[model samples]
Target: MISSVLPTYNRAPLAFVKGAGSWLETADGTRYLDLGAGIAVNALGHAAPVLVEALTEQAHKVWHVSNLYQIPEQQKLADALVEKTFADTVFFTNSGTEACELAVKMARKYWYEKGAPERVEIITFRGAFHGRSSAAIAAAGSEKMVKGFGPVLPGFVHVDWLDLEAVKAAVSEKTCAIMLEPVQGEGGIRPAPDAFLTALKQISDETGTLLIFDEVQCGMGRTGRLFAHEWSGVTPDIMMVAKGIGGGFPLGAVLATEAAAAGMTAGTHGSTYGGNPLGCAVGAKVMEIVAEPEFLAAVNAKGGFLRQRLEGLVAAHPEIFEEVRGVGLMLGLKCRLAPGELVAAGYAERLLTVAAADNVLRILPALTITEEEMAEAVSRLDAAATALETHLA
Candidate 1:
């Protein structure tokens, strides 16, 4: 029988009625420590007081005013983004998927208007997960995402992230841009080497190919930086941001340099619900909190603490965990078995974790999570691993 709602998701049997900080509570008051953070969407944790206040205050004032009119809140967020990063302008969207859609169009359109319409192909990489949109799946070029969706959107060339030679070989005068994530979130938390990113920047500068980074998961204080690209000291011509940017309010944005965004004129792109006062209000609050120097430093310190703990955990459970990967709070446990087994075992321990490709179990807690919470999460993980090991034995 068909469910009332679409069954696209392999949803768990449990449901939470409320959440506070890094914990979720069922209707009967059984609490679970939330390390997944809604797949890295809840930046400030569940029902953060500041974000809740921002949303409610804006909700009381006004909710929706179409993009046809001026939106002061939107302007404030865009200005904040421009000031905090390499961007000169910003366009708001309702989700990361929408941001991906616009990034592709903006990059291609820049060349089309610059009298190079043939320069439309964008060089991408393997193990990349942009979004579920047609353009995003096309950019990934992975068979898992594009198998049934025949006639995938064209103009994307996939290559190996580590093979600088292959990346160079794939680039041509017809190449319009190079798009990739600084860290692969779904393909397992793999951070691109600094040299690889630097080489890509050189390629972009020399060939007039624009550089695009999908920082939806690794940005917004996740990688102990305002953006992960900062760690590599390389800046992309265009960047896509979402997930933690909204603090779970469903907001996304495309930040780009003026030249890159030149073709995205008034009518080039837009959305009815995008950049609404409510979403912008929440997004502005998130930026204000996350962009603070002290907050980010604390995030880095906490990340170090948690990572050290995870390293010890991995050493203690070598039979189950191969190693640890990722940066800041976006850490992953490379499981020896299917990652799903760890996720299920975590549920048994009343802890939440996310599973990803390449046999990894992702641990994406809120940036504000304290050291004590991290220790507790690690303890729970140890217990889960121990139980799984015992069951296997």
Candidate 2:
């Protein structure tokens, strides 16, 4: 362990030296079937030829230019995103946390512009993972994360997910918006009910509050669609996107309807590295590959297959896995054992999976993973479960 670096993350014992497609190779040449995909960032899988070629091609021509100048790549990516989604305007950031910060700022500023300066309270759900920024931490209201982090930011409220009555009761004259993850990723991979999302939209419309969807972990084809909200037929006033947007590179964005972004007229928000040429070029390439109709269809089919296999595993080992949850390739296995123990067992079996909130095992394979890789992941999972069951029994 590197003692110099902060011991913030509870990292696994092994270290991956390289990756290709759905596998990670350690220094000792041991290959592990990677289902987490760098926490769902590698949408195209590792070392995709197209992404490599595009990134390499752009590397020689130019890398970055200040956001002060015109960037054609940024415009192209933004135009493509706007064309496919309900967004009429867009802002770029370098990570999901920044995108989330922008979304929160935009929501409050929008209401302030409408002469409702008191409408600054933003309603967020109880198990939603927005990001790690101060504002995001405050919005999420996770006592575990917010503890000992000085005073929490003000004007944010938390409510029970999918409980319409609690949400209605929480909203007051000061409420400016409601934010949620369309498919909650860190919170045990629980997907918000379709009726609940639709109801939130209805309530937002009735109360004149903005609706923001944090699709950072679940968006960009992770859930077999450009955005998970599409599955529910609900369009958010402001949407935050990251993770798969840049493939393996770092990029995030906040897209919004025209009215919701009116307050962000020049100088309201800016980032030095946001929308630079290098990130934009790579992001454009990623968008080109993932935005295809056939690619999205394959993601859906693959996700269905993965879910079916996971359900079968649950049935076979009811003592280990309680339920399978989530949408598309972002599947989760509710476990009877401690999630960390399962992850450790998986590591010992040379399989890598992510642990999530609520003691669920997160299986977020690449959208481009093949059938054989899916089977291999399940096999390893079964082995790990059996090993743990023997120890526990």
- Specify the highest-TM-score model's number: 1
Error of 1 at 61 (Å): 0.5
| Cα lDDT tens digits for candidate 1, 1-393 | 999989979999999999999999999999999999999989999999999999999999999989999999999999999999999999999888999999999999999999999999999989999999999999999999999997999999999867789889999878999999999999899999898999999989999999999999999999899999999999999999999999998899999999999999978898999999999999999999999999999989998999999999999999999999999999999999999989899999899999999999999999989999999999999999999999999
TM-score against truth, every candidate:
0.99, 0.98
Residues 153-176, model 2: lDDT tens digits: 998989887789988998899999
Per-model C-alpha lDDT, please? 0.94, 0.91
Maximum-lDDT candidate: 1
* Candidate 1 Cα outliers beyond 4 Å, as residue runs: none
